[model samples]
Structure formats: C-alpha cells, structure tokens
Target: MKVKEVTFSYNQTVEQLKAVSLAVEEGKITTIIGPNGCGKSTLLELMSGHYTPKKGQILLDGKAIQQHSPKELAKRLAVVHQKNDVPFDINVERLVAYGRMPYKRFLHSPSEEDEKWIDWALSITNLQTKRKKKVEELSGGERQRVWIAMALAQKTPILFLDEPTTYLDLYYQFELLELIKKLNREYNMTIVMVLHDMNQAVRYSDWMIVMKNGQVIARGVPEDVITGERIEEIYGVKAIVDYREDSGVYVVPIGPCQRDE
Candidate 1:
C-alpha cells in the first residue's frame, strides 16, 4: 500500500496528519510508533476507509484505496482493532465465520471454500481447541487471538493491527509478537500495526515509521530508524540505546525517566 502525500484532519482544527507519504511493503511488517494521540490510529483509520484524505491517495496493488467498494476492501485488507464489542454468547467458529461476510450473499451459509479458510485461520491462530467455546469466557489474550483469527479468516494479503497487545501481561505480549512474526515469515503477509512500546516495535517491525505531531520523522529498517536521539526527539524522554549483537536491533528507553538536577 502506498500513501501518496496524504493529509487528514479532524474537526478542521488540529492537523492530525500533515501531508504524510508512506509505502507499506508486501510480505513485511511495518510498524507506526509515536506518543499518545499522535495520529497513529487515525492513520490506520484513514487507510481503512474511516476517514478520507484531503489531498492525496492511498494505493493498494496499483489501485486507489477509495475506489474499492466496502465489500471489496474487506476482501483485500483485514483489520484487528484495539477493542471490539463482541457478542458474549458467540462461539469462536461462528464468530470467525463472520469474517467471510464480505463474500456472502443473502441467506447464504459457509461454502466449502469458506470452511477451508476458517479452518486454516483457526489452525494458524492455534485456536482450534477453543473453537466451540464462547468468546466472553476467554481471557483477554485469548479474545485478542480470536480477533486475529477472524482477521485471518478474511484471508487477505494485507492485515492492519491497531495495538493488538494492549493491556496484556508480559508473557502474552511476547507471545503475540512471536505469533505475528511467524505469520509474516510463513505466509508472506503484509502487516501494518501501531505499537506504543518502542522496544517491542523494534523487535517486531521489519520497517518502522516514527511519527510525531502527525508527521513522519523517520522511516527505515529498525536498526536504521530507531535511535536514542530519534526517541528523545519524538517522545521527549531521556533514553538509553542498547544494541543486541545477536539480533542487531537497538533497544531504546531503558527507562522512561528524566535526568535529575
């Protein structure tokens, strides 16, 4: 997906994004990182058809994003939002079945092809054991996995994840990141996500886009774009940069604290 000089604003006052231009490459993980309310979510929304750009275009597979119908868009891009209002009694399989809505007709049930895709999605998420369970009874991490399963069921080449690990324990957070990496490596998925943890972003992202005040300050591979200087510049916090020799990724903001006088 390529965003050609897109500009978006909310309420016509705050320039949420200022002429931002970006390209989300295929078969790679691209992460957007910034402080609170810095338009990371808005940028995703714009790409997902929630908001239209004032002066530019978002291109997917050489076609403009806005040109696709909503159903067409659903088949092309799958999204896992930060929060969702799920029905308490819905079984996992039924819920994932909803991801195939883009392909359904009136009074239609799951086709053989849809069932195959759903089964594959459950296997990928390792949620086949919980496929018959109700979503409300599951843990937070489990529910997030269910959400991802639904996205996978969509069977799109592009996936958009908005803070998929929010409010999770350390173990679950690490697990989800690993799962995402596995999906990308094995499936050739084009993944785009927003993450608050800079260190985690560096670990998971193949390419990183650092945004502040609604503009991109840096964009490149993790090692090239994520730096102590860039973190302090974008996030206004003192940080220590640690380079892992094994992985060659720089870990930043050892602590989110300021120097004492």
Candidate 2:
C-alpha cells in the first residue's frame, strides 16, 4: 500500500496527520514507531480504510483505496485494532469464524473451505485447545490471540495491527510478536503495525517509519534509522543505541529530557 501526502484531522481544527507519505513494502514487516499521539495509529487507520485522508490518497495495488467496495477491501486487507469488544458467551472458534463473513452469502453457513481456514488460524495462534472457551474467560493475552486468529482467518494478503502488544505482560508481548513474525515469514503476508517499544520495533521490523508531530521524520531500514540522536529527537529522551554482533541493534533509554512547553 502507498500513501501520498496524506493529511487527517479528528476535529477540523486540530490535524492529527500532516502531509505524511510512505509506502508499505510488499511482503515485509513495516513498523511505525514514535512518541505518544504522534499519528502512528492514525496513519495505520488511514491505510486500512477506517479513516479517509483529507488531502491525499492511499493506494492498494496501484488503485485508490476508496475505489474498492467494503467487501472487496475486507478480502484484500485485514486489521486487528488495539482493543476489541467481545460479546458475552462467544467462543473462540465462533468468533474466528466471523472472519469468513466476507466469503459467505446472506443466510449461508460456513463452507468446508471456510472451516479449514478457521482451524488453521486457531492452530497458528495456539488457540485450538481454547476453541470452545468464551473469549471473556481468557486472559488478556489469550484474548489478543483470539482477535489475531480472527484476522488470520480472513486470509488476506495484508494485515494491519495497531499497538498489538498493548496491555500484555512482557512474556505475552514477546510471544505475540513471535507469532506475528511467524505469520510474515511463513505466509509471506505483508504486515504493518504500530509499536511503542523502540527495541521491539528495531528487532522485528524490516523497515521503520519514525513520525513526530504528524509527519514522518525518517523512514528506512531499522539499523540505519534507529539511533540515539533520532531517539532523542523523536521521544525527548536520552538513549543508547547499541549493536552487538550476536543480537543486532537495540535501544536503551536512560531518562526523560525537559522539553519546551
């Protein structure tokens, strides 16, 4: 997907994204990282067609995103937002089956092929055993996986996640990230996500877009864009950007800096 000079605002007076433009590399994991309210999630929403740009265009496969019908867009891209509201008594399997809605005709049940995809999504998310459990009964991380499973069941070429690791403990955060990486590597899915953890972003992303004040300050390979100076500039923190032969590049923030108000 490609965004060209896009601008967006929530309330007409306050712009959220300002003339931002970037291309999501096909078949690779591209992450958007920046400080709070820097338009990372807003950008993802714009690309996924949840929000229309006020001044630019988002293209999928060279066609304007707005040109596609809702069902057609659902078939091409799946999105997992930061939070999901699950209905009471909905089991994991049933919830995931909802992803097949785009493929179903009105009043028709899931076909055998739809069942196959649902099962595969459950297995990959390690939610097969919990298939019968109510989504509300699961822990935070498990619920997150259930949502991911639903997205996976959609069987789209591109997946967009917004702060997917939010509210999870360290262990589950890493676990979910690993599962996402597996999807990208094994399925060749084009993945775009917003992440706040700089280290995790650098560790997993093939490409990074760093934004500040609603505009992209830098976009490139993680190794080249994630540096102490850039971190200080974007996040207003002192950080150490280190590279080890075995572990690659990582960031360690020391402390916050005083910023002019």
Clashes of each: 0, 0
Best by TM-score: 2
Report the lDDT tens digits of candidate 1 across residue range 1-261: 898888888777778988999999889999999999888999999988878998789888788888899999999999999999889789999999899899888898779989999999898888999999999988888889899999998889989999999989999999898989998999999899999988789889999998988888789998888777887778777777777677666554555556567
Pairs with steric clashes in candidate 1: none
Q: State residue 42's C-alpha deviation in candidate 1, in Å.
A: 0.3
Worst 10 residues of 1 by lDDT: 250-259
* Whole-model Cα lDDT of every candidate shown, in order: 0.89, 0.94
TM-score of 2: 0.98
* TM-scores for every candidate against the unseen true structure: 0.95, 0.98
The true-structure Cα RMSD of candidate 2 reads 1.0
Model 2 worst lDDT window (10 residues): 250-259
**Model 1's TM-score against the true structure:** 0.95
Backbone clash total, candidate 2? 0
